[model samples]
Target: MNTKAEQTKGASAGDIGKLTLAAVILVAVIVAYTWLGNGNVPQPVRLIGLLVGLVVALAIGAFTGPGRRVRNYIAESQFEMRKVVWPTREETIKTTAIIIAVTIVLSLLLGLIDLILKSVILDWLLKLG
Candidate 1:
Protein backbone atom coordinates (compact mmCIF):
# COMPACT_ATOMS: atom_id res chain seq x y z
CA MET A 1 0.00 0.00 0.00
CA ASN A 2 1.27 3.46 -0.94
CA THR A 3 1.48 6.09 1.79
CA LYS A 4 0.08 9.58 1.18
CA ALA A 5 3.60 10.93 0.59
CA GLU A 6 4.44 8.09 -1.75
CA GLN A 7 1.22 8.62 -3.71
CA THR A 8 2.13 12.19 -4.54
CA LYS A 9 4.54 12.87 -7.39
CA GLY A 10 7.07 15.72 -7.45
CA ALA A 11 6.11 18.93 -9.27
CA SER A 12 6.45 18.37 -13.02
CA ALA A 13 7.24 20.90 -15.77
CA GLY A 14 3.50 21.14 -16.46
CA ASP A 15 2.82 22.32 -12.93
CA ILE A 16 5.55 24.94 -13.28
CA GLY A 17 4.05 26.11 -16.58
CA LYS A 18 0.56 26.33 -15.05
CA LEU A 19 1.87 28.31 -12.05
CA THR A 20 3.81 30.57 -14.44
CA LEU A 21 0.69 31.16 -16.50
CA ALA A 22 -1.23 32.10 -13.36
CA ALA A 23 1.54 34.54 -12.35
CA VAL A 24 1.56 36.04 -15.88
CA ILE A 25 -2.20 36.47 -15.73
CA LEU A 26 -1.84 38.21 -12.36
CA VAL A 27 0.81 40.56 -13.81
CA ALA A 28 -1.36 41.16 -16.86
CA VAL A 29 -4.24 42.12 -14.60
CA ILE A 30 -2.08 44.79 -12.92
CA VAL A 31 -0.80 46.04 -16.28
CA ALA A 32 -4.28 46.20 -17.78
CA TYR A 33 -5.60 48.04 -14.75
CA THR A 34 -2.92 50.73 -15.00
CA TRP A 35 -2.68 50.83 -18.83
CA LEU A 36 -6.37 51.73 -19.05
CA GLY A 37 -6.23 55.25 -17.73
CA ASN A 38 -9.09 56.72 -15.71
CA GLY A 39 -9.72 59.19 -18.57
CA ASN A 40 -10.19 56.26 -21.03
CA VAL A 41 -11.81 53.54 -18.88
CA PRO A 42 -14.19 54.25 -16.05
CA GLN A 43 -12.93 53.36 -12.53
CA PRO A 44 -15.78 50.88 -12.02
CA VAL A 45 -15.02 49.15 -15.32
CA ARG A 46 -11.33 48.81 -14.47
CA LEU A 47 -12.21 47.48 -11.02
CA ILE A 48 -14.56 44.86 -12.49
CA GLY A 49 -11.90 43.73 -14.96
CA LEU A 50 -9.37 43.48 -12.13
CA LEU A 51 -11.74 41.37 -10.02
CA VAL A 52 -12.55 39.05 -12.92
CA GLY A 53 -8.87 38.64 -13.84
CA LEU A 54 -7.98 37.90 -10.19
CA VAL A 55 -10.71 35.27 -9.95
CA VAL A 56 -9.58 33.62 -13.16
CA ALA A 57 -5.94 33.54 -12.05
CA LEU A 58 -6.82 32.24 -8.60
CA ALA A 59 -9.07 29.56 -10.14
CA ILE A 60 -6.18 28.37 -12.26
CA GLY A 61 -3.85 28.35 -9.25
CA ALA A 62 -6.36 26.51 -7.03
CA PHE A 63 -5.98 23.36 -9.17
CA THR A 64 -2.28 23.07 -8.26
CA GLY A 65 -1.04 20.73 -5.46
CA PRO A 66 0.14 23.63 -3.25
CA GLY A 67 -3.17 25.40 -3.65
CA ARG A 68 -5.06 22.20 -2.72
CA ARG A 69 -2.89 21.94 0.40
CA VAL A 70 -3.72 25.58 1.26
CA ARG A 71 -7.43 24.84 0.83
CA ASN A 72 -7.12 21.80 3.11
CA TYR A 73 -5.27 23.89 5.71
CA ILE A 74 -7.98 26.53 5.67
CA ALA A 75 -10.71 23.89 5.96
CA GLU A 76 -8.91 22.29 8.91
CA SER A 77 -8.51 25.72 10.57
CA GLN A 78 -12.25 26.44 10.22
CA PHE A 79 -13.11 23.01 11.63
CA GLU A 80 -10.83 23.53 14.62
CA MET A 81 -12.28 27.01 15.17
CA ARG A 82 -15.75 25.49 15.64
CA LYS A 83 -14.46 23.46 18.62
CA VAL A 84 -13.17 26.56 20.48
CA VAL A 85 -15.10 27.62 23.58
CA TRP A 86 -15.00 31.40 23.24
CA PRO A 87 -15.44 33.60 26.27
CA THR A 88 -18.77 35.39 26.74
CA ARG A 89 -19.05 39.20 26.33
CA GLU A 90 -19.38 39.58 30.14
CA GLU A 91 -16.28 37.52 30.73
CA THR A 92 -14.34 39.48 28.13
CA ILE A 93 -15.40 42.79 29.62
CA LYS A 94 -14.46 41.72 33.16
CA THR A 95 -11.10 40.40 31.98
CA THR A 96 -10.39 43.63 30.12
CA ALA A 97 -11.35 45.72 33.18
CA ILE A 98 -9.09 43.68 35.44
CA ILE A 99 -6.19 44.01 32.97
CA ILE A 100 -6.65 47.78 32.76
CA ALA A 101 -6.82 48.11 36.55
CA VAL A 102 -3.69 46.04 37.01
CA THR A 103 -1.87 48.02 34.35
CA ILE A 104 -2.77 51.34 36.03
CA VAL A 105 -1.63 50.07 39.45
CA LEU A 106 1.63 48.78 37.97
CA SER A 107 2.23 52.09 36.20
CA LEU A 108 1.68 54.03 39.47
CA LEU A 109 4.09 51.75 41.33
CA LEU A 110 6.78 52.06 38.61
CA GLY A 111 6.34 55.85 38.49
CA LEU A 112 6.78 56.08 42.28
CA ILE A 113 9.93 53.98 42.07
CA ASP A 114 11.33 56.12 39.27
CA LEU A 115 10.55 59.30 41.24
CA ILE A 116 12.41 57.96 44.28
CA LEU A 117 15.39 56.96 42.16
CA LYS A 118 15.56 60.38 40.50
CA SER A 119 15.31 62.14 43.88
CA VAL A 120 18.02 60.01 45.39
CA ILE A 121 20.40 60.25 42.42
CA LEU A 122 19.89 63.92 41.51
CA ASP A 123 19.02 65.51 44.86
CA TRP A 124 21.40 63.54 47.09
CA LEU A 125 24.34 62.66 44.83
CA LEU A 126 24.44 65.86 42.75
CA LYS A 127 24.33 68.08 45.88
CA LEU A 128 27.57 66.45 47.04
CA GLY A 129 29.34 67.55 43.84
Candidate 2:
Protein backbone atom coordinates (compact mmCIF):
# COMPACT_ATOMS: atom_id res chain seq x y z
CA MET A 1 0.00 0.00 0.00
CA ASN A 2 1.20 3.53 -0.87
CA THR A 3 1.92 5.79 2.09
CA LYS A 4 1.74 9.08 0.13
CA ALA A 5 -1.43 11.19 0.12
CA GLU A 6 -3.54 11.23 -3.02
CA GLN A 7 -3.61 14.56 -4.89
CA THR A 8 -6.96 16.08 -5.80
CA LYS A 9 -7.31 17.29 -9.40
CA GLY A 10 -9.07 20.41 -10.76
CA ALA A 11 -12.79 20.59 -11.53
CA SER A 12 -14.37 19.33 -14.76
CA ALA A 13 -16.17 21.44 -17.40
CA GLY A 14 -19.52 21.37 -15.61
CA ASP A 15 -17.95 22.50 -12.36
CA ILE A 16 -16.07 25.19 -14.29
CA GLY A 17 -19.40 26.40 -15.63
CA LYS A 18 -20.65 26.93 -12.09
CA LEU A 19 -17.50 28.88 -11.23
CA THR A 20 -17.92 30.91 -14.41
CA LEU A 21 -21.50 31.72 -13.45
CA ALA A 22 -20.27 33.05 -10.12
CA ALA A 23 -17.62 35.22 -11.85
CA VAL A 24 -20.26 36.56 -14.26
CA ILE A 25 -22.43 37.57 -11.31
CA LEU A 26 -19.48 39.41 -9.73
CA VAL A 27 -18.78 41.25 -13.00
CA ALA A 28 -22.45 42.19 -13.26
CA VAL A 29 -22.25 43.71 -9.78
CA ILE A 30 -19.20 45.78 -10.84
CA VAL A 31 -21.03 46.93 -13.97
CA ALA A 32 -24.00 47.99 -11.85
CA TYR A 33 -21.73 49.91 -9.47
CA THR A 34 -20.24 51.82 -12.40
CA TRP A 35 -23.63 52.37 -14.13
CA LEU A 36 -25.04 54.27 -11.16
CA GLY A 37 -23.72 57.44 -12.93
CA ASN A 38 -22.36 59.38 -9.94
CA GLY A 39 -21.35 56.63 -7.47
CA ASN A 40 -24.11 57.85 -5.13
CA VAL A 41 -26.09 54.61 -4.86
CA PRO A 42 -26.51 53.88 -1.14
CA GLN A 43 -23.36 52.03 -0.04
CA PRO A 44 -25.24 49.61 2.23
CA VAL A 45 -27.55 48.36 -0.54
CA ARG A 46 -24.61 47.79 -2.87
CA LEU A 47 -22.76 45.86 -0.19
CA ILE A 48 -25.88 43.83 0.58
CA GLY A 49 -26.32 42.90 -3.06
CA LEU A 50 -22.73 41.67 -3.25
CA LEU A 51 -23.09 39.62 -0.09
CA VAL A 52 -26.39 38.12 -1.23
CA GLY A 53 -25.03 37.23 -4.64
CA LEU A 54 -21.97 35.55 -3.11
CA VAL A 55 -24.10 33.55 -0.68
CA VAL A 56 -26.42 32.40 -3.45
CA ALA A 57 -23.49 31.41 -5.69
CA LEU A 58 -21.92 29.45 -2.83
CA ALA A 59 -25.21 27.74 -2.11
CA ILE A 60 -25.56 26.73 -5.76
CA GLY A 61 -21.97 25.47 -5.80
CA ALA A 62 -22.55 23.39 -2.68
CA PHE A 63 -25.85 21.87 -3.76
CA THR A 64 -24.92 21.05 -7.36
CA GLY A 65 -23.11 17.69 -7.92
CA PRO A 66 -20.00 18.82 -9.85
CA GLY A 67 -19.87 22.15 -8.03
CA ARG A 68 -19.88 20.31 -4.72
CA ARG A 69 -16.46 18.71 -5.23
CA VAL A 70 -14.97 21.96 -6.54
CA ARG A 71 -16.35 23.92 -3.61
CA ASN A 72 -15.18 21.30 -1.13
CA TYR A 73 -11.67 21.41 -2.58
CA ILE A 74 -11.59 25.20 -2.14
CA ALA A 75 -12.75 24.87 1.47
CA GLU A 76 -10.08 22.24 2.17
CA SER A 77 -7.37 24.52 0.74
CA GLN A 78 -8.50 27.36 2.99
CA PHE A 79 -8.39 25.03 6.02
CA GLU A 80 -4.83 24.00 5.10
CA MET A 81 -3.79 27.68 4.93
CA ARG A 82 -4.90 28.13 8.56
CA LYS A 83 -2.22 25.64 9.65
CA VAL A 84 0.69 27.83 8.38
CA VAL A 85 3.30 29.04 10.90
CA TRP A 86 3.61 32.80 10.55
CA PRO A 87 6.74 34.72 11.53
CA THR A 88 6.81 36.30 15.00
CA ARG A 89 6.69 40.08 15.53
CA GLU A 90 10.31 40.17 16.70
CA GLU A 91 11.48 38.26 13.60
CA THR A 92 9.56 40.60 11.31
CA ILE A 93 10.99 43.69 13.00
CA LYS A 94 14.55 42.31 12.85
CA THR A 95 14.23 41.59 9.11
CA THR A 96 12.84 45.06 8.43
CA ALA A 97 15.66 46.71 10.42
CA ILE A 98 18.35 44.79 8.52
CA ILE A 99 16.84 45.86 5.20
CA ILE A 100 16.69 49.50 6.24
CA ALA A 101 20.30 49.49 7.50
CA VAL A 102 21.59 48.00 4.21
CA THR A 103 19.61 50.53 2.14
CA ILE A 104 20.95 53.49 4.19
CA VAL A 105 24.55 52.30 3.87
CA LEU A 106 24.26 51.84 0.09
CA SER A 107 22.66 55.28 -0.33
CA LEU A 108 25.42 57.00 1.63
CA LEU A 109 28.16 55.20 -0.35
CA LEU A 110 26.57 56.21 -3.66
CA GLY A 111 26.15 59.83 -2.53
CA LEU A 112 29.84 60.09 -1.51
CA ILE A 113 30.96 58.73 -4.94
CA ASP A 114 28.63 61.19 -6.72
CA LEU A 115 30.09 64.14 -4.72
CA ILE A 116 33.69 63.09 -5.49
CA LEU A 117 32.94 62.82 -9.27
CA LYS A 118 31.18 66.21 -9.28
CA SER A 119 34.11 67.92 -7.51
CA VAL A 120 36.62 66.44 -10.03
CA ILE A 121 34.43 67.55 -13.00
CA LEU A 122 34.05 71.11 -11.62
CA ASP A 123 37.85 71.44 -11.07
CA TRP A 124 38.50 70.23 -14.69
CA LEU A 125 35.95 72.72 -16.05
CA LEU A 126 37.59 75.65 -14.07
CA LYS A 127 41.03 74.73 -15.46
CA LEU A 128 39.63 74.77 -19.03
CA GLY A 129 38.09 78.25 -18.39
lDDT of 1 by residue, 51-77 (tens): 999999998888887778778778878
lDDT of 2 at 108: 100
What are the per-residue Cα lDDT tens digits for candidate 2 across 86-109? 999999999999999999999999
lDDT, candidate 2, residue 90? 100
Roughly what TM-score does model 2 have, to 2 decimal places?
Answer: 0.54
Give the backbone clash total of model 1: 0
Please report, as a residue range, the 10-residue window in candidate 1 with the lowest summed lDDT.
1-10
Q: Give the TM-scores of the predictions, in the order they appear.
A: 0.84, 0.54
